[model samples]
Target: MASHLDLEEQEQLEQVKAFWKQWGNLITWLITAVLLAYAGWQGWNYYQRQEAAKAAAMYDALDQAVQAADADKAASVFNDLRERYAGTVYAAQGALQAAKVQQDKGQADKAMASLTWAADNASDDSYRDIARLRLAGLQIDAKQYDAAAKSLDAIKSADFAALASDRRGDLLLLQNKPAEARAEFQKALAAMDKTLDYRRLIEAKLATLGVAVPADDAASGAAK
Candidate 1:
């Protein structure tokens, strides 16, 4: 009976070895793959953090240049930032800041170029919309009426609809299309948030056009 038990144990050991032989290589390879993937993920996250840190430092330099009101320096730093860190939010913000400095320095062409870059390359939708809005205003100031209209038309976000309408009103008024301007202002007033101080400005615009908000509509808007 002892010899029989020894034989049974030997048979069980052999079955275990056979199972390992069939599956051991596959299990080892799967574990290696998982480890490699985890290491790659960690490396990617580290790279992103390093990139953001570098971008933040460059953005700080751009900010200092802006504070000094050195338009040329700001533009130079902004160009560097855009070239190296265009994928970062800092680059988009730098474009906006540089554009403002350029505009204040009477560099209309440079300002427009910066704004156009932000509008075309910003990762965030709101930033793009803001760039387009400011660019439209600058185009208007330049008396590039057609270009201003094109910029306004490119604004796609509903959040900016009222502002875009207001700008369109300005454009139409400049073109001596008062009737069209009034319609656009009315659209702006209708879309604008009633609680905003800017809404009152739109109302004043309508007033200048010899149009008044109907009493009932005014009351309804106030109630809202």
Candidate 2:
């Protein structure tokens, strides 16, 4: 009985060896691939965290420079942050801060350039919208009316529709297109919240054009 049992064990061991010979390389490669993938994922996560920390620190420096009213230092730090961390929100914010500094320093052209960069390249749509709005305002001040209109036209935020329309109306009025201005003002009035004081201003604009907005229109505008 002992000899029979030893023979059975030897047969089982041989069978195991045969299985390994047939599948050992494939099983080893599969396990290695899984481990490599897991390691790569972990490494990438760590790298992203490190990058975010660096960007955050740079942004903090930018904020401090701005708060100290050091436009030159703020501009330098902002440029560095924008160049090194363009993919992060910090870069867009830095661009805005740099633009503000340039504007405050009476560098209108530089401010416009910075705002244009942010408008064109910001990762967030809201930030881009803000940049475009500011750039349009500057263009208007410069009497580059056509360019200002084009910039304002590019804004697509539903929530900002009323303000954009009002700006367009103002631009049209400046261009001596009273009819078009009236139309834009009406659109603005339609889009604005009825409760907002700005809506009353728009209504006044429409009234100035001899377009009487109904009371119901005003109430409905407030409801919005």
Candidate 3:
């Protein structure tokens, strides 16, 4: 019985060896590939963290330059951040800050350039929307009413709809198109939150056009 058990164990060991001989190399290569992939992923995460930290530091410096009212320094830092880290949110924010500084310094052309860059390249849609809104306002100030209207028309956010409509009304009013202005004012009134004083202001505009907004209906619509 001892000899029979020994023979059985030997046969089992031989079978296991045959299986390993057939598949061992393939199994080893698969495990190596998986480990390499995991290592690469971890390395990439570390690289991204480092890059973001550097971009954030540069953005802070740009903000400080803007706070000091150093338009030239702010512009230089902002350009560097935008060129090097355009993929980062901080870069877009830095551009907006630089644009505001340029505007305050009476450099309308430079301000528009920064705003246009932010509008075109911001990684965040919300940031791009804000840039476009600000650019439109500047265009309006420059009396480029048609271009401002076109910019406002391109904005698609429901949250910005009221403000965009109000801006459109302003542009139309500036152009002496009272009927078109009234239409935009009505749309603004419809989009605005009932509790907001701005909604009342829009309502007043509509009233001037002999278009009465029903208070109860507006309140009920807002409640919904």
TM-scores vs. true structure, each candidate: 0.88, 0.83, 0.85
Best candidate, TM-score-wise?
A: 1
Candidate 3 clashing pairs? none
How big is the positional error of residue 73 in model 2, measured in Å on the Cα after superposition? Answer: 2.2
Best by lDDT: 1
Off by over 4 Å in 1: 1-13, 215-224
The candidate 2 region of ten consecutive residues with least summed lDDT is 215-224
RMSD of each: 2.6, 2.9, 3.1
Return the lDDT, model 1, position 29. Answer: 99
TM-score winner between candidates 1 and 2: 1
lDDT of 3 at 49: 96
TM-score of 3: 0.85
**Tens digit of per-residue lDDT, candidate 3, span 2-55:** 999999999999998998899989999999999999999999999999999999
Number of backbone clashes in candidate 2: 3
Cα deviation of 91, candidate 3, in Å: 1.0
Scored against the true structure, residue 174 in model 2 reaches a CA lDDT of 87
Looking at model 2, residue 157 earns an lDDT score of 90
For model 2, the local distance difference test gives 0.88
Order of candidate numbers by TM-score, starting with the best: 1, 3, 2
